[model samples]
Structure formats: C-alpha cells, structure tokens
Target: MTAHRAKGLQWRLVVVAGVQEGLWPDLRRRGSLLEPDRIGRDGLAEPLTPGAMLAEERRLFYVAATRAADRLVVTAVKTAAEDGDQPSRFLTELGVEPRDVAARPRRPLSVSALVAELRATTVDPAATPALREAAAERLAALAALRDDDGVPLVPAAHPHRWWGLYEPTRGEVPLRDRDRPVALSGSALHQLATTCSLQWFLGREVRAEPPATAAQGFGNVVHVLADEVASGGTPADLSVLLERLDSVWDSLAFDAPWKSRQERENARAALERFLRWHVMERDLGRETAATEHDFDVTLEAGGHRVRVRGSMDRVERGPDGRAYVVDFKTGRNKPTAAEVERHPQLAVYQIAVREGALDGVEGFTGRPEPGGAELVQLRIGAPKREGGDELPAVQRQPALSSYDGDGEWVGELLADAAGRVLDERFTPSPGRHCDTCSFRGACSARPEGRHVVE
Candidate 1:
C-alpha cells in the first residue's frame, strides 16, 4: 500500500505482522529500481537491481510504522527449520524484542464475532460534527446508486485507477486509456496537498507579498554588514551605513518624502540598537549544546531548542539558564507585545521549549530558569542625536517576559494554546498592525483601507 492510503487514519494499537531480514531495513536494496527510464526500442525493459527493490521495501515499511498513531507492535514468527533463526537483522538493529508465537495455539474467528469486533472499533470519536454530516451525505448518495448485477456495492474501484475516478477527466477517452496515468513525486504531492489545505483554510487565494523597495534597500545594507562580519571586520564604520539609510529612503516610493524620512530614521534607529545588542554589549551568545550541533538552551521551564543554521542574528546564554532569542529587525517599525503574542511562530517556539522537545537544551546549565524566554528587539538606525548619547533612541526590550519561575503555569498556558492550534481557532486581530503585516491585503479581518483587497 502507498503512504497516501494511511493519511487521516489513526489507531490506538498497530500491529506490524511481519518484519524479516528482507522486509524491515532491507539492506540488500539499491536505489536504481525506482528510477524511471525513458522508453527505448525495447519498451518496458529497464533493468532492476535486487538492492533497489529491497530498499524500496524498507522505505515502505518505514512509512507504514510511522503511520501508527500511538502504540506499534511488530511480530516475526520462527519455524522449526529455522529453529536457531535469528530475527530480522533490521529488528536486531532497532533493538526490538521478537516473541516466538509458534509455541502458542492460534485462535479461531467466527463471522458474527468478526462483525461485532468491526462494529466496536469502526466508529471515530474524533471526527468533527461537520465531517460527520459530510460523511452521512456521501453515504446517502452512495446508497442511492444501483449496480448492473442488482447487488449493492460501495462504489469500489481498482486502486490503480482511484485517482482517475476521484479527479475530473480533462477530456473524453476510451475505457482502455481512461486511467491516464500521471507521475507525481512524494514530495511534490505533499507540497501540493499542503498548499491546497492552506488555501482552503484561508478561504482565499494566497500569494507572498513582494518585499517593499525600501525593505530591499535596507536588506542590502544588512547583506554588506553580514559579509564584513563573515570576513572578520569590526563594526565601527558608519559611512556605508549612512549611505545605506539614504538608499532606503530614496527607494521608499512614498507619496510624502517627509514621511519616508521619518520611517527611515525610525528603522535605522532600531537597526543601530540591534547592532549594539550583538556587537557592543555581546548580550547574545551562540553555542552548540546538543548532538544536533544546533542552538539548544536549557531553561527553568524546560529546554528550548532552535535551529539557527541561516536565520540567527545572535544567540546569547544568560546567567540564569535563559536563552535570549534575537532576530534582526530591518523592516520599518516594531510590532507590539499583543502582536507578538498572537504570532504562531513565536508561540510554537515557546511551546517547544516548555515541552522539553529539545533534550540538549533542557537543564543544560543545571539550574532552574524560566521556561518562557525573552525575545530581544534591536532597532538599527543612525548614531544617537548629536547632543545626546551615541546610543540609538530605540533600545532593546524583551518582547516576552520570563515564565521561568512558574513552569506549571507556562505549561498550562501552552496546553491551552496547543488545543487552540489543533482546533484551528486562530482569529486575526487587525488594526494599525495591518500596516506592516504581509498578509494584510488578503486577511478577512484586516482593517478597511485603500490597500486592502476585496
């Protein structure tokens, strides 16, 4: 069976009846068997290797086991001829215990007993009311169908032709070619499904907003700084920086030049503050704490792990076993605390840390610290006003307060938030905040404005 068949199906107990040497991690399998070759003079004559076939089987087994909702049981029976039979090498590798069931007698099954068992387990408690209603309507429609043999059928079709039956035909074709086959990579199908689901959930078409010219200009400045830092250059010069600010303002395409100037100045100030947090104060720290060789930090709430391969600005470890998650702000203006709280990306990170999903990060410092960490915001901008201190006006502030001391409370909050996520209960809180949201135009709850989409 294909992995797609397992979608949306869950079981409390799963039994993998067979796991043998040639079945589990089929080590004899090679990769070439699955590769498609163009038709040649000899049609359908592509060579297949034993290794490739075995590898494919192994992958199928992996897919099958991952589909188990909770508990998984793998069984392998041994026969007398193979009395000293070693369990599947893959099972040995995975450290699974294989029980010899041949010594026990098999149980018999009756038709009524089997029917009762199916009835007991077929009901789904987790199905939503809407889903139940839709299923009932579908069943009713199916029940209305009559077969040529005068026998009721459940609309069954060959598994290979299922897609064609479900999808609309592009054109009329004879029965022989009715099931026009189309190839789709697993990854491609997954991405397509994800995109379709997102569009359905949003109830509208979705497209990424092109970055503003102003934002792009500032991004160039950041690109230059990043290059210099990579080359071991110190952050002391302001010439390229000033030019960067000027470029950003010039590219604003704003109706009012003064308004652009104000926005550029505000953004520059934020960037400067951010630079201080990274360079001057060195408040951010980076260390590889886990075998994952990524950013993991231990906290009082639990352990927080973050993958910072390309997107990290600066990572700092605090004395109290807290991690200061910092991301650079090149965009104009800063989001408010309420906006941050509503953002799922940040909320998920908080939840991940609280759940101890990051093993290396949890209690790494061997101290109790807040599970809810702080988010530091640094605004980069021009040097402080001439008469005032050189420090930028928009200094760093913790976007999230510490929840380290109250792990239990944080856990409760995360549990509630997780439930909301599972139930898809997100609601947009639009206001002035929409001015900066990339999704503003398409969001249903976005404030009415000239920029809003109908």
Candidate 2:
C-alpha cells in the first residue's frame, strides 16, 4: 500500500521498497491539469516552495516509519552503471547507513531463479550426496507443479528442457565446399589481394557489410549525375545539372545543415570536373562505346575455376581504335601511381576484354583489344600546368601485353588471391585501412577483439 493510504495506521512490520534518489522524496514538481492552486487568484498555478515540499515528503516518511510497531525495513540498490540508482538522502537522515544496506545480497525474486540455483546445487561435485539428492527431488517436484488452470508453473525445471543438453541444429559442417568454384567480382579481387582478406570474408562471404553512410549516398548521386550527362539524359549546363541535384538532395541524410551544404557544393565541383573531362575527351576525337558495360567471364586460377562478374563504368574507343576502360572514382583519396600501375581490378577488366567478354557487343564487331584503363577521380583536382585547363585527376594503368611481364604478374596475383579465397584462409592483414574497418570489433588483430574468437 502507498504511504499516503497507510497514514495513522499501525502495523507489526512495514517494508519500504525503492528508497532510491529521485523515487523516495520525488522532488519533481508535478503540475496539475485542473490548476486548483490558481483557483483563488493569478494567471498560472504556483509551485510549492522547495522547503515546504521537502517538509511534506519528510512528514509522510515519518508517518510510514512510525506505523511499524516492531520494526521498519528500508531498501535501496546501488547499481553499477553511470546513471544507476543511489540510496536516498532520507536513509542517512533516519540514522541508517545506506552503504551497508546497499552492499547486502539481493533475494531471489522468481521461480526460475530459484530453479536455476537448485539445479546448480544438484550438479555441484563438492556438494554431499544427500544435499544433491534433496535438490534433485525439489526440482522434480517443481517440474510437476501446476497452476489453477492446470498449466505447468515451473516448465523450465524439466530435465528434457535444459538448454545445455540440446543438440546443435546443424552438426559440424564446413561453411564452403573445397572443390566448389568460388564466384568473385572484379572489385573483390582488388580488395582481397591489395587490402585485408578477413575484411573481405566478413563483408562479402559472411554478408556483414556496414550500413550505407552519407558519404556513400553523396558518391552515388554524383555517379548518377555523371551517367546522366554521359548518356545525354542531362546536358552539360551547370544550372541544369544543379537543378537535378536539388530535386534529390533532400533524400540523403546529413548530420547538420553546414555539412549538407558543404557536400552539395563538393558534388557540384565533381560534376563540373566530369563535364570538363568529357568535353576534353570528345574534342580529342574519342567516342564513348558504352556507359555501363556488363561482363561475366570464367578464368582458370590456381587450378580452380573462378567466375568473375562486374560492370565497367565507361568504355571508350580510342583514336587508335583500341577499347579503353574508364572507371569513375568519386572518393577524395586517389590511389598512388605505383598502386595504379599493378591494380588488380584494371588487370581483371583487361583480361576479360582479351577473353572476348566484350565481343559482338554494340560497338565491337569482333574482340576489341584493350588499349588501357584509367581511374577518373572526380573528387580530386588535377594539378594545373602552365598551359593546361583545370580537370579531374586521371590515373592510368598501361595496357597489358602478352609479351610484357605485366600480364604474367597479374595472372600470378589472381591465382594467389583465388587460392586464399578457396581455402577460406582470411588472415587479418593490418594496415592504415583498419582504422575505418567495420569488423574491427570482431577482428582478432586487436587485443580487445581477440576475446571474441577465443
């Protein structure tokens, strides 16, 4: 019963629970919807003075304590969390030590808790045989107990229902078959070989990819705008392109107004750079064969068949009549010149072209030889030369040739990467990229995450 309802009553024993700060005295000023305090005079109801409110709460507490003729017990809990409970100041004022009381062991509050304790006692090797037998009998009795409606009250106490004794749903099966062909993408080949393999396994194999962020959304819109302009859906006019951007700008979520504005402006700069690059290429007599070209090819790597499927961003027929692969990169960080020279993704695309993946397509009558591939970084500005126009940075990977050593190295890298994927050997390779990895919390490379695997 509430303290207010028990006023002036006497009892042999009384127990006050939840005597924690913010609960007992409850100093919060509760406004009334009826506004009875303002009935006499004034525009709004007046709150009780702090001193008066304290006195009233104290009086109620005193009344509750005095009702117990024999003994009165006040309880509180001190929780471990930062915003957890604390004993009320009233306990100290009543000459009770809050610390000693809070440190005492809590009583079990449920049948399940009692059953768990009894089950533990029954299995304890240190326990006497007689004690273990007594606990087992009690557990059996609890399992047979029923409610007024005949439903078993302690259903979990049944031995057959124990969790630890249950058999696993799938008994000891390997995740992937060793002889099965490993399906891969052009981009996955690059990430697995050049970056961390554990990251590739968790993200691709386990399908634990992180949620898309604002930066990813921004990149997507810019890529779409670039595609539209390239396909002639939207003109090269800045005003027209920006109008289209504004139409879908609200779809992307940004942390703040300033961040949204900044990203929008950055996207504008990217579009301008793309237009500049496109116009420059057109003026140089280059023709775009396809905007988004799809390809699927199978390669024999490490004595295993690896199916590679991916889409190229843009394919252009150079003045020399050789096909050129153009990959648009909207990210700020551009790959180093050395990394670009031996890039796996570009090499895979070149291999696909040589293997007739693009043969009999709209622009190609027969197999078109890959002249070269280049990463067009729209977010990075090219360093201005004395007589050059401002444009996006372009990192080119020279065309692979059978006679040159470049093609042989690419084949070796592909085989090595394919072997790792097939064997499911995803050893964590730490690098600067680990700082942004989503699986860092589960990765064994870090000391804290090591416990997860153990």
Candidate 3:
C-alpha cells in the first residue's frame, strides 16, 4: 500500500520497500498545469525550493514509519556506479544505520524454472545415484500433469517435446526420391548446380530466402516496364516510361534521397536502352515472338530425367526464321563472353528451345531451333563514340549448333545437377557470391556457420 493510504493504519510489522535515494524522496517538481496545490498557499509565487521539497518528503516518510507500532523494516540495495539503489537520507537522519542483509536463496516460482531445476538435479555429476533417480521420478510425475487443454504443465520434462532427439519428419528419405525427376527452373540451375548447392537447398528447397532489397525492386520495375513496352501496352517513349516509373518509384525503400534519385536515373537509362534495342531489332528484320514465355520440358541427365521449367524474358525470330533468346540484365556487372557461352540459365533456355519448348507458340514460324542468345546489359552503358548517343551493352553467345556436338556438355551439367539433387548431396561451395548469400549462417564452409554443423 502507498504511504498516503496508510495514514491512520497500524500493523504488527510494516515493510517499507524500495526506500532508495531517488524514489523515496522523489525531488522532481509535482503540480498540475493549473497549479491547484499552490492556489491556497503562495498563489504560485515561485516553485518550492529543494530544501522545502525535501522537508515535505521527510514528513511523509515519518508518517509511514510511525504507522508501524511494533517493528519496521526498510529495504534498499547497495549502491555503486552500476547499481544506483542508495539508501534514502531519511534513514541516516532517523538514526537508522543501514547494514547489508544476506538474501535467502529460493527457487523461482514458475513451472519452467522448476523443470529446469529438476532437470539439472537429474543430470548433476555431484549428486548421488539415488538422489538423481528421485529427481527423474519427480520429473516424470510433473510431465504427467496436464491442464484442461491437455498441454503438459512442464513441457520440458516430457521426452516427446525434445527436438533433435527423435527421427526427422521425413525419416531418411531424400528431398526428391531417386525415381522422381528433379524439377528446376533456369535460375535454379544456376544457383543449385553452378553456384552453391547448399545455398540453393536452404533457400529454395526450404523457402528461407531473405526479403527483397531496393536494387531488386528497381530491377523488377524495369523488367515489368520492358515487358509492357514489348506487349504494346505502353508507348516506347522516354517521357511515358518515366511517368510509369514514377507511379511506383516511391514504394521502393532506399537509404537516402540521393540514392533513390540515382536508381531512378539508372532505371530511366535501362528503359531507354530497351527502346533502342527494340527499334534496332525491327530495323534488323528480327521480330519478337513472345515476351515472358513459359516453358517446361524434360531432359535426360545423369541416368535420370530432369524437368527444366522457366519463363524467357523475350524470344525473337531472326531473318533466317530461327528462334533467338534475349535476356535483359539490370545488374551493373556483366559476365565475360566465355562465361556467357556456358551460362547455366542461358543454356537451360536453349535446351528447352531445342526440346520444342516454343514450337507451337504464336508468332514463332517454322522450327523453334536455337539461333543464338545474348545478354542485353541495361545497367552497363555501351562504349560511347565522340558524337554517338548512349546505348546498352550487348554480350552474345553463338547458337548451340556452332558448338561441338551441339553443346552436349550442358546436358552433362544438367545430369550432374539432377543426380546431386536426387541423392540430396548439397555440399557448400564457397565463392565470391558468399557475401550476398542468405544461408551463410547455416553453411558449413563459413566460420560463423561452423557451429551449426559442429
């Protein structure tokens, strides 16, 4: 009870808890905005001085102390720089010498705490065998006790509640059974097979990928705008594209206003690059067969058939009436020509095309043979001539027909990837991309993630 509420009350023993320096004599100014307490006294002439306020607090403390007729106990913790609980000055003024009191050791009052104590006792090396057995028996009794809802009162005491002690949810079965085909997308082939397989397993297989960033959002907007332009839904004009970009530009989060503006400019440049490329394709007698075309096909790999499925950004028909793949890149870095030759993502699309992925699609005349593939790097500007305007950089990969045995090594990669996935062999392969990988904390190759495997 508060000191004010114990005015005329008497108790056999009274405990004045929290009699600390700052709290017992709270020196902060106290009065409503209307100054009601000062109305009958000084009429708000001036605020009460520190000495006057201290005197008032001392009198209140005296009232609380006098109410205890027989015995009184005042509590205050030892004061230090870290612990600021000092005994109130009133204790010294009233001839009470503060002395340290040894705290009584007691068990915490909670089911979890009790379970922890019992568990510790059962496993204690210093305890006798009989005492440990008694503790185990008590824990079993507690485990048997349940509330009306049927949930155990002490969950930790129950053996069934312990994780990592029982068989896994799927037992010893692989993620994808041996007989079943490992279904993978073009990008998945890159991450799972080419890059880090463990990263792919944790992020894609378990769906533990991190949230998207501002750069990702920017790339998404550019891709959508490029698609709209190709589909004739939006005009291929700079002003119109900027207007469309402004509609959702503020939705993306950036660290600063200048960064946001810079990204906006980059997006504008990407759109401009797309416009130029589109116009050039028309002039070169190349027609867009499809935009964001979905494809799914099965291929023989590593003694097992793997299902490759994904959407192509754009598929074009060349003057020779062969299907060509064009993938727009918003990332600042562009791969070298040699890397593009064996790029897993591009190889997947070409393999799908060879497997009749877009044979019956509209605007695709004759056979859907792989003519060639190119990465239209929108983020990286092309080498500018003295008087020429800025253009997008293009890195081309020749048609599969030009490669030896029609690029059969790509099939070997697919088979290897499929075999690993079927066998659930996801070993961590550390690379330059590790810095941006989301599963670094769970990867065995990383020092920070070593504890997980250990």
Q: What overall lDDT goes with each candidate model?
A: 0.44, 0.82, 0.83
The lDDT, on a scale of 0 to 1, for candidate 1 is: 0.44
Residue pairs clashing in model 2 are: none
Model 3's alpha-carbon lDDT is 0.83
Q: lDDT of model 3 at residue 302?
A: 57
TM match of model 2 to true structure: 0.68
Clashing pairs in 3: none
Local lDDT at 205 for model 3: 88
lDDT comparison, 1 vs 2, better candidate = 2
Q: What's the lDDT for residue 160 in model 2? A: 78
lDDT tens digits, residues 1-454, model 3? 8999999999989988888888879898889887777765645567799989898899899989988889998887665565666788778876767778666447774787787688779879999999999999998999898899998777778867644454434447668876767799988888876789888888888888888899899989999998998888998898999999999999999999999999998888788877988898888899888899999998886577888899999999888878899898999787777889888888888878988889888876656789888888888877665112367888787788521267877877888788778768888999877988888876779987874433
lDDT of 2 by residue, 299-333 (tens): 77657677778988888887787888899998878
| Backbone steric clashes in candidate 2, count | 0
lDDT for predicted candidate 2 compared with the true structure: 0.82
Question: If the candidates were sorted by their lDDT against the true structure, best first, what order would they fall in?
Answer: 3, 2, 1
Candidate 1 regions with alpha-carbon error over 4 angstroms: 1-205, 208-213, 216-236, 240-272, 275-280, 283-312, 319-322, 330-428, 435-454
The reply for model 3, stretches above 4 Å from the true place, is 1-173, 255-258, 384-389, 402-404
